[model samples]
Target: MKKTAYITGGSKGIGLGIAEALLKDGVNVAITARTQNDLNEAEKHLKTIGDAEVLVIKSDVRNLADEENAIQQVVDKWGQLDYCIANAGVGKFSSIDEMSEEDWNAVIDINVTGVFNTVKSAIPALKKSKGYIFTIASLAGTNYFEKGAAYNASKFAIVGFSQAIMLDLRSYDIKVTTIMPGSVATYFNGHTPTAADAWKIQPEDIGQMVVDLVHMNPRTLPSKVEVRPAVPPSARK
Candidate 1:
């Protein structure tokens, strides 16, 4: 049977790219997002790619119940899950003094809590299959910059959480990895991915890395991967 993967925020961006790559490799994929329209559109695009089974679920990952339901939906359809990608995250840029509590909460709730819920809900099935768990974090998880107080905090928390889980799940032969990407050309931050952004990494590049990692020897685990653009645009003096 083909391996099954559950990817949160798979309706677009890096999540969608990974799903597409896995589909081409004959892996079944279940994708979740908050919007039904987005899921529907993603399903259509996934179909064009390959023969892999594609399941779409509408879910808001911040809600524990929703995350559980999404995982259950995948298990019901696919029977087992071999991979879990907690890629759903949100970001807001603001100085610490100007950041509102609501903004901070929103970032934390979606980035930190959402990842927690995704992993918690999928752990049972993952333990059963001895599967792999990959978290889509940011370079901010380790590096900080201005106007990134809330976003940085959330990502930093994710790195620590992911590393701890890696240790916790190692006994089960379940691998855990945190992928921290610096800059990617995607429809993130209200900007659409474009050729002009070729200098930055592409979503598919990350997808390919996931595929490679999955195919590695079981005894080897690359716990952390930090990726960045080879060259970044600089302001003219």
Candidate 2:
């Protein structure tokens, strides 16, 4: 039987990296993004990487209705949902005083409430499949830094949220894990990946981490994974 996964914010970067890895393993994948063009491009590229059927949906994680409809469409097509990944997130770096209400809401809405919406919508199908849930958190979630107030708060909330849900879903044979990564090379925060970023953790590294999680023995559940580069930024100097 073929596995099926649904990922949010999968147009590019880490989410796309995960999608590519899953597709390479012949897992039917449905990826969601807020824009139609990004989904279109992702679908085209994803087709070339793997033979698994690809579904691209334009949906915003911040919108509960959109999240529900997207997951419903995936189940409607595949008849089952094995994994739901909440990889959609946003970051706005500014001092507490400099940040506007609009910016704060954007980060919190997409990072915290967005995961809530995705998981809530996916639970019915996930329960049926006894599926897995993966939340792409960050090292920032645990280690707070200056100017990271909003992003840190949101990710911190998700870390606690993921672990709590793990306990809740375990009785039904569902597994949940939050992956916290440090300094990954990706097009995040309006910066593009370049050769200088070779020292950082590559997005595909996290992708492979997800693949490994599924391959683990069913009796064993690793609830939280913290990944970082072999060398820190300071060490590179």
Candidate 3:
């Protein structure tokens, strides 16, 4: 039976790349995001990559109801869900004193609470399938830096949360892994990828990692993974 996967924020960047990889493996995939236009574009592009079925859902991870409904849609369409990637997140950078309440809340709400909702809503389905869960975190989760107060706090929370849940869900035969990546060449933070960004990790790299993990021996679980560029730009200079 072909496994089914669901990805949040799968309209672009890492999410889209993951979807393409899974699709190539013949996994039926459902991808969700808040924007209909982005989803439409993603759907079109994804279809060209693989023959696997693709389901695009318009969902906002911050809303529990929306997440619940999105999962339900996946289960309803695919009949089973073998994997879920809670890749929906946001980053807001600013010093504590300079950060607006709105920006702080948005960061926490989307990055932390969003994953909670996505995972919580998918638990019942995953339990039945003994599936896998992947959360997209960042190196900043552990390393603190200036102007990263809000973003760091959220990613840090995700790393801890994903680890705790890995323990909680293991008995159910479900695997949870958190991927902390450094400097991916994506449209994240409103930064367009240019030639200068070639040195950064590409989204497809992360996608390939997920595929490898899914194919790993069931007895061995890599619960936490940290990825960085092989050679940073500074090393060349």
Strongest candidate by lDDT = 3
Quote each prediction's TM-score.
0.97, 0.98, 0.99
Candidate 1, overall lDDT? 0.94
In model 1, the worst 10-residue window by lDDT is: 228-237
lDDT of 3 at 6: 96
Q: How big is the positional error of residue 140 in model 2, measured in Å on the Cα after superposition?
A: 0.8
- Model 1 vs truth, CA RMSD: 1.5
Clashes of 1: 0
- Backbone clashes (count) for model 2: 0
lDDT of 1 by residue, 119-237 (tens): 99999999999999999999999999999999999999999999999999999989999999988888887998778888888889999999999999998999999999876887323
What does candidate 3's lDDT look like per residue over 1-237, in tens digits?
Answer: 889999999998999889989999889999999999999999999988878899999999999999999999999998889999999988888888999999999999999999999999999999999999999999999999999999999999999999999999999999999999999999898989999999999999999999999999999999999999999978885
Tens digit per residue, CA lDDT, model 2, 133-176: 99999999899999999999999999999999999999999999
Question: All candidates' lDDT scores?
Answer: 0.94, 0.94, 0.95
**What would you estimate as the lDDT of candidate 3?**
0.95
Any residue pairs clashing in model 3, and if so which? none
Rank by TM-score, highest first. Answer: 3, 2, 1
